[model samples]
Target: MKHSICSFVICLLVCTGSLASAQQANPKYDKKLADSLKADAYGMKMYYLVILKTGANTTENKTTTDSLFKGHMQNIGQLAKQGKLVVAGPMKKNDKNYRGIFILNSASMEEAAALLNTDPAIRHKLLDVEIYGWYGSAALPMYLPYHEKVEKNQ
Candidate 1:
């Protein structure tokens, strides 16, 4: 009985040590992947501010304004297809007064600014475009795969 109890304790200690080591070894971001992301960002990242436009004087020219809105969406779709857009949509509820948002990836702010300037929405005065620098972590929330595993186990 004494020997069995000693062996069980030793096994438990070994298992606990191995688990702790494994946990420590796990990292949120992989070094190689992060390096690649940094490289990608060095070339691909450009900051953009999406201006939300609201309908003015809703009482008159509703149809004309609606047609203009459709054209704006088309321009956005074109940009998205060309991989210039990162994120685009309207503002959430309880946010500032803006009809939509767009995140663009370009070589420089000037290039992004130029692109926005050419947009039909801006030309038609349907919306305004604000360009800014985008600076953030390369790793996405979903990139941390270990969190899912930990949650599953729990």
Candidate 2:
């Protein structure tokens, strides 16, 4: 009876130790797997052209536009530092045209729109900004192969 009790206690300790070790091992592998899965799902980054329509001919409106443009330029630098704004620049040669382009990572179109809607430039309405979804070779890894096929066919 004494020998049997001793053996049982030793077996229980061994099993508990193995289970603890297994739990620890699983977290390491699980983290690696989770990271890989996330990369696969959200690897593609998206871009947008923000068209800021300038209001016509009111002194107050023009002044507001000027002030907003200056503030937006400053905010843009901060956004870039935070990894929110990928690239941006004012539109050239036209008073009413896309003011800037923003490239960002988002899970969906809604998410991208939401991010744009939060921009101070959009909120102030000094410029009417439209966010247009951009799909191209630069953003998608699969684009080149598809383009090559089209070119070959042509």
Per-model TM-score on C-alpha atoms: 0.54, 0.47
Whole-model lDDT, candidate 1? 0.63
lDDT of 2 by residue, 1-154 (tens): 9999999999999999999776543323444544533333333334554556653433456667677667777776666555455555566766455555566444466776676666656667655666677643233332334544676542
RMSD of 2: 13.3
How far off is residue 118 in model 1, in Å?
A: 3.3
Model 1, 23-113: lDDT tens per residue? 5533354667656554352323234656656534344377877777787788776776675665677776554557777776666788787
Q: For each candidate, what is the lDDT?
A: 0.63, 0.57
**Which clashing pairs does model 1 show?**
none
Q: Model 2 misses residue 56 by how many Å?
A: 6.9
Clashes of each: 0, 0
Q: Which has the greatest lDDT?
A: 1
